[model samples]
Target: MSILLYFTIVPLGTAFLVTLLRKKKGISDLLAVLSSLYLFGLSLATAGLTKSHGVMIYKVGGWFPTIGITLVVDGLSAFLLVAINLVAFLVLIYAISYMERYTDKWKFHALFMFMLAGLNGVIISGDLFNLYVFLEIASISAYALVAFGVKPQNLEAAFKYTIMGAVASIFILLGIALLYSYTSTLNMADVAYCLSDKAKNPLLVFIWVLFLAGFGLKAALVPFHAWLPDAHSSAPSPVSAMLSGVVIKTIGIYALMRIFFNVLGVSINLLSVLMASGILSMVVGAFLAIAQNDIKRMLAYSSISQVGYIIFALGVGTPLAILGGLFHLFNHAVFKSLLFLDAGAIEYSTGERNMDKLGGLNNKLPVTGYTSLMAAMSISGIPPLAGFWSKLIIIVAAVEAGYIGYAIVAVLISIVTLVYYLKFQSFVFFGKLDAVYNKIQEVPLAMKTALVILAVICVMGGLMLTGTFRPFLEGASNVILSGTGYKQAVLGAIR
Candidate 1:
């Protein structure tokens, strides 16, 4: 079997086995960790393979393109795979100790693996219909995971998320149906080839609107962002990390980029729309986050804002802008996941998430406090951290593209990001020790190990832009800049 197939299959097979082993103590956790480790290793191997071999196309059952399902791994897919799996493996490691407080740990592992499978499937799918199927698989698993706690708030958040998610799915399906009607092909590359000659079609305009709304909602961009805060805050911390770290990027941003850049091709109008939405999300999410008392809720809102930076960078539509956007996507996944895990660690120790109620945690939970400090610094675009480089690239790209107003807003909002994260640090870690948390202690070894590892990444991730890691980011950027040439690239790889 092709290595690409393992990305989806390993998680799926593990999920099923975990379900059967639910009654066995320790076994489920062991399986979950091992599976995640394997997936991370596979993702790294795939990246190396792609770097050496270029684009790879794997057809299911020896069938030909347009007739058989295909998995295409180019630079973009490889980059996302590595980001997703790396965060996932760390999150799983955190979960091993953190989840001891909750019952039915096996079920959590099972759902998590299912979600991983869905994410991997989405990244690799070359068929539009297959992408939708994998999207649903991931979405459904996420909804269940969000409600895993079965508390009133968890249920409420999951319901709201499901309603919004179902509507988005409908919009995407409608768009796909219309595109299929026009082009008579479900294969994404073939659809791109068919659409290239019909640039002026009015139906194409309608399809674009549908896809934009659908993907925008999934990505939690501004007006479509109501569901994110509640869901991210209510879900388990590890699950929240997964949701904010990768789920939005894979199902929302990645899908939108694939459909718009590779299939419909970039246009001035589309770029403008993306830029406008991004700016709105960046400004609005920041302002809303400032008022949040819940640490997780603040982090959730910050996600919407950071994602805005990414979308805005992509909308700049220059090679540098695209590179910055992809780099930020990876950086955000790392630090944001770290931040959420920190939030979880705090809650794990003190059983409180409201910043107003928490104080002087650094004395009790030194690892969590310091690691969170690193993440907060990184997210705030402080120099020498991963976040600063990507944000700098994006702001410079905007200035170069003559979107000076957008660049200004990005800079101002970045300061806003710093303000709130500083608030988080002060409220949770720096003030007088709360009498209530006096008995609290540092989290377990597993949790500390995860936090330390992610913090180390946050510190050094910027180096990726300079040395041996440069090609990984550049390779993904090249794919996006290639635009509709993606069709030729995929077809040529197959031939």
Candidate 2:
């Protein structure tokens, strides 16, 4: 069970070690990439182990739940671990070459590892206070990373992100405090066990509202999404990939799901609220994306829209719907990360992010062009790609749940998604090559390697719903479906 600690410790330690080795040439890169690779492999192994071993629990210093910090690696934890570490590893690889334009590349490596550590901790931590702590760690690192360029826009974006992130943290802390005062414990499983026995009241209702607002802000759901586009577009491309692909999912959606479904328990009212928010985010985000000329900004807005599918599916509260949500979560991480990296490569080669200023890159940057095309298609829900299947499942599940109106809106949004992505491909890759960019070369091998692997995943990702890969997603969905029974699983695992 101590293996859970490695996910946190290695990255945190590597972060510190990278800081010390900042002056050494290449050492920081080596350590950061190696640590990320190890964590990715370990996460994959943990996924396998959890599927075979059931839930595993680790108590710090031999203390029991409610008495000490506990770490758990259930199906959900392992599933997220794999997604987070895999994306981190790939982003680290992409950053190796992409970050050369900046000074103090080692600092980026350090902060990235810190964020990775925090993300892993958020998934594995068994208590609410620790979850908040880990969330802050990740949030703070992200704020700084967004400003890594120190450009005026980057500074402004980071400041806005810091302010919004602080507000969200405060909301989450206040909710945790109220929950603790009522239940007399912070261990999530114990809190759930306690809450299950108590009658619902006004204070609990207030707690739910607070937590939803807090996590909703972090997740950048509609009305709460002001910070995401700027923060994501201003950050380095690899950082953008991490932010849109895994960070929001981890500290935002993942936290929301863990608390609402497993610890606090879900209700019809809560589910309806989620559904409404999801639809709003979907429509608003897609329309905004269609209006963007900046490539990274468009992708950032697109992320908010794609995330809506996941949120809406989860809100549907059906078994098939939960499975669809989780599947789309995983698929979004892959294709979105790939799309951002492709954007970075284009910028790296031509120093242009405005789609209108770009054209005919297909022949010159074949790798970037084709990969971007694949990712754009996947995100647009084109058939036979990973994104299509997840979106299909979500739409099908929505109809099955008798939310025919929601399903219709989802289908409409998917069409809008395809529209903007076609705009992306047309303006950037399919037209006449700009004379200024004619001499620009493809990105370095490292960036292309990251893009190609992710593209391959986008192509093959549909297979996840079949064969051995299905269990990884199913296991995670089963955890959410289990609801308050999560407490019994954790406590029983401890025994």
lDDT of 1 by residue, 1-495 (tens): 288899999999999999898888999989989999999999999999999999998998889999999999999999999999999999999999999988999999999999999999999999999999999999999999999999999999999999999999999999999999999999999999998877578898999999999999999999899999999999999999999999999999999999999988989999999999999999999999999999999999999999999999889999999999999999999999999999999999999999999888898999999999999999999999999999999999999999898899999999999999999999999989978787888999999999999999999999989889999989999989999999999988998
Q: What lDDT would each prediction earn against the true structure? A: 0.95, 0.95
Q: Give the true-structure RMSD of model 2.
A: 0.6
lDDT of 2: 0.95
Report model 2's TM-score to 2 decimal places.
Answer: 0.99
Q: Provide the lDDT at 66 for model 2.
A: 84
RMSD of each: 0.8, 0.6
Q: At residue 495, give the lDDT of candidate 2.
A: 86
lDDT of 2 by residue, 125-156 (tens): 99999999999999999999999999999999
TM-score of each: 0.99, 0.99
